[model samples]
Structure formats: structure tokens, C-alpha cells
Target: MQKRKHWNLGAKLAVAAAPFALLALLSISLTLWVSWQLDGGAAAVNEAGRMRMQAYRMSLLVAAGERTLLPDARSEFERSLALLSHGDPERPLFMPRDEDIRSRFDAVGQHWRQYSKHWLDVRPADNRGLREETARFTGRIDALVAGIEAHMSRWTALLNLMQLATMALAVIGATVLLYIGYLFVLEPVGQLKQALERIQQGDLGTRVERNSSDEFGTLADGFNDMADQIQAMYRNLEAKVSAKTAELQEKRERLEALYEVTSLIATARSLEELARGFVGYVARAVHADGVALRWSDEANRRYVLIASQGLPAYMTDGERCLRADECHCGAPNAPPFARVIPIQALEKEGLQYCSEAGFETLVSVPVRLKDRLMGEVDLFFHAEVDLSPSARSLLEALATHLASGMENLRLNALQHEAAVSQERNFLANELHDSIAQSLAFMKMQVEMMRTSLSAHDETGTRAVLDELDAGLRESTGDVRELLLHFRTRTNSEDIEAALQATLRKFEHQSGVRTTLTLREQGLPLPPDLQIQVLHIVQEALSNVRKHARAGHVWLDVQQQPQWRIEVRDDGRGFETGDGPPDETHVGLHIMQERAARIGARIEVFSTPGKGTSVVLTLPASDPTLLDLPPLQAVS
Candidate 1:
């Protein structure tokens, strides 16, 4: 394995370049110091040369002593020379006695002294000698001054050339240092920065590679090693994740199989059918020898085997009584095989059963609805099989679903039966009140006419005629009442409106008083129940009119959580023990049947001198029942 270079290359490069940067700064300082010293030397020489020229000019003026010369000339010349003795004065003429320049300055001063003496002596001589001598000496002094000026100009040009060369060298050195920094430092750091950015972006494949055997190279090597390790770890993690994912997929399929079995049971229409299907599915799913289902019928207080499959005939068909301690499947100390199992204890005790049933192990699940024990499902295996936790959970879930479905089905059957009975009662009332009564009245009228005609003589014919007319009127009224009864038989008519119309017609026809009272409103009774209620009212009113022969009828239709209809008559009444006339007692029987169909009870009250009152009380309509078509009157 290669040694890893985990350190950053850019940071290493910066560390390595720090000494070179310091060296470059030191070189720059040395060059500046040397140039400054050279400049100072050149400036001193120039200032000294300028002072020499001034001294020579003043000496010539004093030697000539022309009338233009003032007495202040000597003083001014001494002051100018004194400036050279002060430290770093206005002139650069500080030459020591040992210097070659000091010897030249002494020789120049001796020559000027000689010229001054000669000129001063001749100034008092003849005019011609003075003029000639002064001209010659002045020409000599001007030539010497010109030679000194030429020497100083040459020296100044040399100093300027040295300074320019030093500046050029400093500029070139700085440029070289900058280029080196960019190549070795900035360029490598930029590459390292880009590599780090790629790593941050999740490109673990990035590797740093520097050619030199420096700190940067070590960093590159480390980076490559780290990337390699990370890649290896990532691959290993992927393999482990793949294995776990496959395991989860297998578990999901198993759970789906369990869900399918439960769904099949839920859709089964009857308990027997549902249990048969459930057992078959479970047997296949769990590979059981057989499955059995038993339930406790609360009303009968007996445990019955409602369904079974792949089981012995004795186990399914035989009548069995369940004890809290005994196994119904002929197993010893086996799981409790009752409709209500101790769900919480099923896992710990694993079900108490007898081993004699030739099964090594059995699992029993209780079916409960709203805390009531409705049934149990039992599966028997030939030998103990290792059932997984998921399998046990699925079984429990299925049991819960089965419990709810069974309860719902039971309620549905009861409601259907009640609806059928209500329909039958409604039909009976329509037949008796409308069709039967119409036929009976027609028969009575025809017989009466026949009897009168048979008894008639020619003179007594008018009397018979009057009797026939009265009977015909009564028959017509009966027929009209029958028609009205048929028209109102349908329960869909607003019950209150229908009852009011019926009473109004009765009052109009018989010239009797009628009143209706209602209590509670907005009760949505089912059509069948409504029709049964309507018939009860109609029958009570009919009996009142025919038997009680009451002058006034008070019909009260009331609603609460329960439905009730009561009809009272004020007329000659009979004893409660007195039955309806033998030929016409069907009305009372019809009324009782109608009340029973809607889960209602009817009561009748009467006395010899008081009126008759019939009351019908019924269970209220269940709002959740399925809607049915409106009833149509038979007519």
C-alpha cells in the first residue's frame, strides 16, 4: 500500500515559499542601501567642485582690485569658504589631508596666491605692464577652471549611469521572483483548490498528483489513499444494503399473502361460507392439516361448529359443549378452542389443548366483536412448525377483520327480515279494507233489495221502494269509502296529510265530528313501516265507524324516537272481552298483524258506556337503512 498524503498541497506550498519570499525582501533592501550610499558620494563630489569654482572667482577679483570691486568682496568670499568646514554643509568639499583631492586643492590655492601677488605689485607699476600682466594671468585662471568643470561633469555622468544600472537590476529581480511565485506556488495551489472542490461535490475519484518530492507530494499521496479507502467502504456498504433490501422485499410479499386471505374472508356472505373460505386460505398459507371454526350463539347459549374443512366428520358435525377449560377439538390441554379466546394470553400459553387429536400443535384465534365472543378459528398442524412473528401478527389481524364482518352480516339479515314482514302486513290491510269490504257491502245491498221485492204487494210497493233507495245510498257510500281507502294505501304519501284527508272524508260522508292531533315531527320512517302504520290507523277507524257507531272520532298520529298512532271514538262502546262479530273480526286480526310487522304492539280500550280507543306503538325507523322504492296502492 502506498503511503497516504492527506495534507493540503496549497498550504504546503505556501509554507515552502516563505523563506524564498524573505530572501527576496532582504535582497531588495541591500540594493536600495547600496544605491543610496553611492548617490551620497556623488552629491558630495559635485558640491565640493562648485565651491572650488567660487573660491577661484573671488581670488581673481581681489587680485585685479578693479574700481568695480567693493570692500565687501573679501568678506563674501571668506563666508562662502567657511560653509565647507561645517558638518554636511551646503558644499561637499570635506576632503581630508591624506586624500589626493586635498593635494590638488592645496596646489590650486598656491597658484592663485602667486597670481594675486604679481597682479597687486603690477597694479602700482606703469599702466602698460599692469594691463598686459593682468590679461595673461586671467587667461591662465580661466583655462584651469574650465578643466575642473569638465572633470566634474564626467564624474556626475558616471554616477548617473551607476544609479540607472542599479534600478534596472532591482526591477528585473522583482519580475523573476513574481514569475517563480506564480509557477511554483499559485499554479499548484489553484490545482489543489480545484481538486478539493471536486471532492466536496462527491467526486471521490479525485486524486492529487504533484511531481516533486516535497511536502506537496506527500499531501497528494495522502489524498489519493483517503479516496481509495472511502471508495472501498462505499462498495462494502452497498453490498450490505442490497442484502437488507432483498430481505425486506420477501417480508412484504408474505404480508401481502396474509392480506389477501383476510380480504377473501371479509367478502364472504354467510358465516359458514366465510369460515370455509378462511380455513381453506389459511390451510394453504400456513400448510396446516385442517381448520375448524366454532361459534357461541348468545341466544341459545351453546357453542356450535358453524364451519370446517379438511377435518374429521365427528369434529364438525358432532354437537359439542364448550367449557372454559376443555378443548373442543379433542386435544389435551390445548389452546382454548372457543369463540372468545384470551387474545392476550394466546402467545404465552400457546393455547391449551389435548394432544390426542394427532396434532403436535394448534393455533386458535378468537373472533370477537365489541367485546363479545362471537367465534374462533382453529388451525391444526401435524407437527410443530416454527411460525414467524409476522405470520402470527397476520393471523391476529385476520381474526379482527373476521369479527367485524360477522357482526355486520348478522345485523343485515335481521333488518332484511323485518322489512319483509312490514311489506306483508301492508298488503293484508289493503286487501281487507278496500277489496274485501267493497264486495261485502255490494252483497248486503243486493240481498236487501231481493227481500223487499219478495215481501211487496201492489199497494205496499212504495214502502219497498223507499227501503231499496235507502240501501242503495248506503251501498254507494260504502263503495266510495272503499275507493278512498285504496287511494291512500301507499305509505309514500305524507302520513299526516293522508290521515287528515281520510278523516275529513269520513266526517263529510257520515256527518260526524273528527279531529287529528300529531306530536313530534320530521321522523323519516321507512316506506314499509310507514305503510304498516297507515294501515293500523285505517283499521282502527273502520272498526270505530262500524262497531262503535261513534258521532265523533279523534285520530292522533304522533312521532317520537318511536312511532305511534291512536284512534278514539265517542259512541256506544262494548266490553273489552267482547270479540268482533264472527263474520267481520278479520279487521282486528289485520290490525294486530300490521303492528307486529313493524316491531310495534297494538292495544284496544273499550267499555259498555264509553268510547273505543285503539293505540299502535312501533319502533322508530333506522336512518341508516338502504333506500327502497315508494309503495304503490293496489288500486
Candidate 2:
């Protein structure tokens, strides 16, 4: 097939209109030529008629015997004849080229020449019937006029025929133009419209046919290219949307796993429970077949399996304890990053148990807290599995959470141990200062009583016996006081209630009238601090019972402007020479030690024959109390 030529819309339209334009121009040119030729026909006819009129006028002048008029009329007749012979171009008078008309014109001119000469001969013989002669010449003039009229009539008919032919050609040209427009413009536009409709209706596969190398063809090619791009973009968009949805789903799973592990950490009472729950959740989240959690020593040498979600019983037992240098799974010293290693890549001795279980892939994630390598988590897969960055990150996050949970449990255990040890020490101190000191004094008194008995001093022995009996009673009371202090527990909600209970018990045991005055002004002290304060108050009360010998003891507690407590006794008081507390005043020392533990100050005021008052003042800005955790069980 021959390649077609390309033309734009303007060129196509111009080509379609060119033939009609030429035909119209030719038609108009033909009409103007015919009209121009006929334009002088009327003038020629009028001039010929004027010649006949001049001939008749000349004859009449001759008949009138007016010789002067005859010459003038004769000259006028000649002038007309001359004008007819050579037509006036400026006046637009043109003689017809028809042979009949030309012959008749010549006859008219020849007859007039002969007739004019005879009429002017000046001889009567030359003159015949003037009318008859003039009439004969005028008849020839009439023939010429008739010939001109006949020629003009034929040209007018030919002009009408030419106009009719032009109209027919114009109709044919318009019909052809309409057909071309339908083929080139309307049909192509229709096809393009249908293709656009298909695309708009969601059929991205629609394409236009490129049948011609024209504007429509270019348009078709462009449309096809655009459709290709749109279809490609649509496909790409669908892929992107699918990938995004999958990414969001993966993220959601990770978040859920994190939340489950976080809840486990918060609620689990032991590291084992937290690790078990963490491994189980991680295995499910990442679609792993088996998961194991391990803990290593500070030096990262020994690994102890803390928890496992899935594994053979034998494999779990055999791999329960492995060193970092011997195990392929929990090698914390190898690298800090989580990695997916093929089970077969490991040495047979390191992970032969995993390979024997038909596991193909293993992912080891390190659990770290700060800079210390805590342990590693191992995930086993039955089939080969590739971990994306997101998946690996999720596993690492779970490991980090596990590390934090384990560390928190460890810290809590240490804190509990420390608290227990401190309580034990406090009890020991209380025993040594009170009961132990009392026992040592009784021992010395027994020695003195023995010495008196050996001397046979009856008064000294009786006195020593009374003193020993008093010492025994005092020791019994101290034992009971120690027992009360050991069993004492403070109320967390209200310290006043615990203080009231202590005072009631003290008044009942010792028969010493006790009064408690409490004034609260600010937020209550923390439970730990309150417990220490209550213990100090108890110690002071114990001293009042043993040594003060007061009738009434008053305990005052103030919470405002700093925690302040005072134990006042109206009893015979000993002198306090402030160098250090008397070695025997172990109660005062114990009270001061208890006060110092909670950032409080203690003061003892006593005078001979006057009362004694023990005061405990806590600083307003005691930062140590804020960090003290809730008091643990005393035991």
C-alpha cells in the first residue's frame, strides 16, 4: 500500500474549497466577458438607427429644395455613416462580428455613398423620385439594425446557458464537499467521541484507530499513548494501594504485639511469666514456628533458656543451658543486631539440635538494656523465611521490651531485699540497745548480789535482791515493749489513727496516763516516711515508760510547716550534759537513729527536778522521702 499524504484540517478544508473557488471565478469571468461584449451591442444598434434617421432627414432636405440645409444634412448623414463604419471605443459602441450583420452594414454604407452623391449632382436628370431613393437606402439601414438585434439575442441566450452550467457545477461541488467532510471530519470525530466515552466509562483499554496520516491520525496516536499511560498508571496505583495496605497491616500487627508484651510486663509477677508471654506473642506476630527466650550472665558467657513457645521436649531440655561460645542462637557477644541465619550455616555442635528438628531458618534478636548485652531471642522456622526490615525491627522492639521487663523485675527484687535487710538491722539495733543492755546490767547486779551473800551482809543482800527483782521486772517490760514494736504496723491512710492506737496500748500497758495531740496541715507523709516516724514515736514512748517514771506522758504530732513530733513527760528528769547521749541512754540514741533515717532532726531536753521532752523535727524540703517506695512487708 502506498503511504498517504498528511494534511491538517486547514489544508484539507482549503483543498476542498479550491475547486469550487476556481469554478466560481471562471463562471464569473465568463459572465463578465459576455456582458462586456454585449455592453457595446446596444450602443452599436443605436448608432445604426441614428444613421437611418440621418438618411431620412437628408432626403427631406433635398425634397424641400433647401440647398444650404441639404449640405448640412448631407454632412450629418456622412458623419453617422462614419461613426457606424468605425465604432467609437470610448462610447463603447462595438459592431457585431456576425457575417450577416457585417454584410448588411456594408450594403447600408455603399448604398448611402451612391445615394448621397446622386442627390447632390446639381442635374435634374440624376434626380429620380427622392422619397423612393431615400426609402431604398433607409431599408438597407433597417436590415443592419435587424441583424444587430438578432446577434444580441443569440449572445443573451448563450449567457443564460453559461449561468445554468455554473449552478450545476456548484451543486456538484457542494455535494462532494459534504461527502469529504463526513469522511474526514464527522466520521473521525465520532470515533474519537466513542473512545472518550469508553474511557470515561472506566474502560481504560479503549484505543482510537489511526487510519489516516492527518490531524485526526495524530490525535488518535496521542490518545492511544495517553490511554496506555493511564492504564499503566491505574495498574501502578492498584499495586501501590495493595502494598500500602499490606504495610499498614504489618504495622498494626507489630503494634498489637508491642501492646500485648507491654501488658504482660506490667502485670506479670515473675520474669519467667513475662518472657513466656513475650515469646508466645512474638512467635504469633511474626508467624514463626518456634520461639525461645534466653538470659545471659553479665559477661555474656552463659545463656539460660528463660522461656520457649514451641520445641521438642528433648530439644528444649538439651538446649536449656548453653554458653554464648557454644550456642548459635543466643550468641550475645557475636553482634548486637538482629539477624536471620540459616540453621544449616551454624556448626553442627552449636545448633545441630535445631537442624535435627527440621527447622530451616533462625532469627536471633539481641535483648539489650543500655549498653549491657542481656540475652538473645531465637525464632525457628520450618520453611525458609525472609525477614523484612519492619519485621526485624518489630522483633528487636520486643526484645528490648523483654530486656526492660527483666531489668525491672530484677531491680524490684533487689529493692525488696534491701528493704528487708534494713528492717532486720533495725530490729537488731532495737534489741541490742534495750533488752541486751538491760540483760547486761542484770548480769552485773547478780555478780554484786553473790558478793554480798559471800560477805554475809544481811542488809546489802536484801537490798541487792530487791534491785535484782526490779531489774527482772524491767527486763520483762522491755521484752513486752519489743514485742509490741515488732508487731506494730502503721495505717497508710491516716497516721493519726496509728499514733492513737499506739498511745492507747502504751497507756494500758504501763498505767501511765497518755494524751495525744495531732494537727495536720499539708499533704500526708508517704507510707515509708510515716512508718519511720511512727517507730521513732514508739521508741520515745518506750523510754518514757522505762526511765521517765512520769504520771502522765503527752505525745504531740504536727504535719504542717514540717513534720514535728514531741513526747513530753512530767517526771523527775535527769540532766542532759550535751556531749553525746549517755551510753546508757540507748533509747535516745535509737530514737535519733530512726529520725536520721528519714532526714529528720531529734532534740532531747531534760533538767533535774524538771520534765523531759523529746522532739523530732523533719525538714520541709526532704528529697529523700519523695524517692522512697511504698514500704514493703516487715517480715
* lDDT scores in order: 0.61, 0.83
Of candidate 1, the 10-residue stretch with the lowest lDDT total is 336-345
Candidate 2 lDDT by residue in tens digits, 410-461: 9989988887887788888877887787788888888988999899988988
* lDDT for residue 123 in candidate 1, whole number 0-100: 55
For candidate 1, report its TM-score. 0.50
Residue pairs that clash (backbone atoms under 3 angstroms), model 2: none
Model 2 stretches astray by more than 4 angstroms:
1-243, 330-333, 345-351, 445-469, 486-494, 511-515, 518-520, 578-586, 607-610, 622-635
lDDT of 2: 0.83
